[model samples]
Target: MSVKGQYSATIVIGVCGVGKTSVGHALALALNADFIEADDYHSAENLKAMASGIPLSDEMRLPWLKTLAEAAEAARQKRPVVMACSALKRSYRDLLRDKIGKVQFVFLHGDRDMIADRLVKRADHFMPVSLLDSQIATLEPPTSQEDVIAVDVALPKTEIVDIVARTMRTRQNADMTALNSEH
Candidate 1:
């Protein structure tokens, strides 16, 4: 599918405290797309569990994932959307792609120490620093087959956003060229 211009949807994924929300917000602003936080879709119970430093099981996260996927699908129907999600597993990301077609993923990556430091500094967030290890344990870095653009989270938020925006534009151009060549 051609996602040129303002007709694409991207998910910014990473472990907790990897700056997914910050980068996703900047990327959405740069692309002039709708921004959605996957955590916002989490149920109250899930939030409570996370706040209590308990890691959510895969079974507990299915409904939340489905909700985020549905929201992405609906947002993409009108315009491009950028979602900040901690899609730690390939299966979790696959579920999202299954629900919404042709979604791009931006995986923010950083060293565990760096991310844990960030998490410790973060205030007013439901996710506790104690769960950082669990989140990291669950993370399965995206493979080439997953259509992901992995970015180093050590960069400035603006730079990360620029990189993602440029990458999306390039991918869209390539997709369009391929579609046109098939005609």
Candidate 2:
């Protein structure tokens, strides 16, 4: 992983109950990088709307996403950053990439039944289980054109972290090789 001078930001994206926080923290630890929880950047209004079981409109989410992007950039000033965010739309991901250059993504994907089961067990979050469907509906899975690696949410957290960490290292190696070749 790039430590100081290189631009490195990894956004762990998925629906609400896909264990983004757990996986993100573990991945950050594995990479010796900073961990930024996107949920923490949500405005009070946004949190209220989510808690009320009302899905946020794209306009409502714009500020939150921009805040998260700024937070990632600030965190990256010290080291690489791993952030847990839904980033459910392609435009949102594009905005992030534009704000923070060379951003990578880990998409945690799973069946609705599996994710719903996970959401049922959560008691501390403001996001109601009812909103999962809306989020899933909004999600635009990363394509081959994006800098992304898809991982199954059903995998154990440890395994997921290991997989992402290894993949990140591989990507870093490839980037270095390409840079050297250019020189």
Runs in model 1 lying further than 4 Å from the true structure: 1-8
Which lDDT tens digits does candidate 1 get at residues 1-183? 434333346899999999989888888889888999999999999999999999999999999999998898888878889999999999999998888777789999999999999998999999888998998889899999988999999998888888888888887888788878877
Q: Judge candidate 2 at residue 37 and give its lDDT.
A: 94
How does each model score on lDDT?
A: 0.88, 0.89
Q: Kindly provide the TM-score of model 2 when superposed on the true structure, using C-alpha atoms.
A: 0.95
Q: Against the true structure, whose lDDT is highest? A: 2
Q: How many clashes in each structure? A: 0, 0
Candidate 1 lDDT score relative to the true structure: 0.88
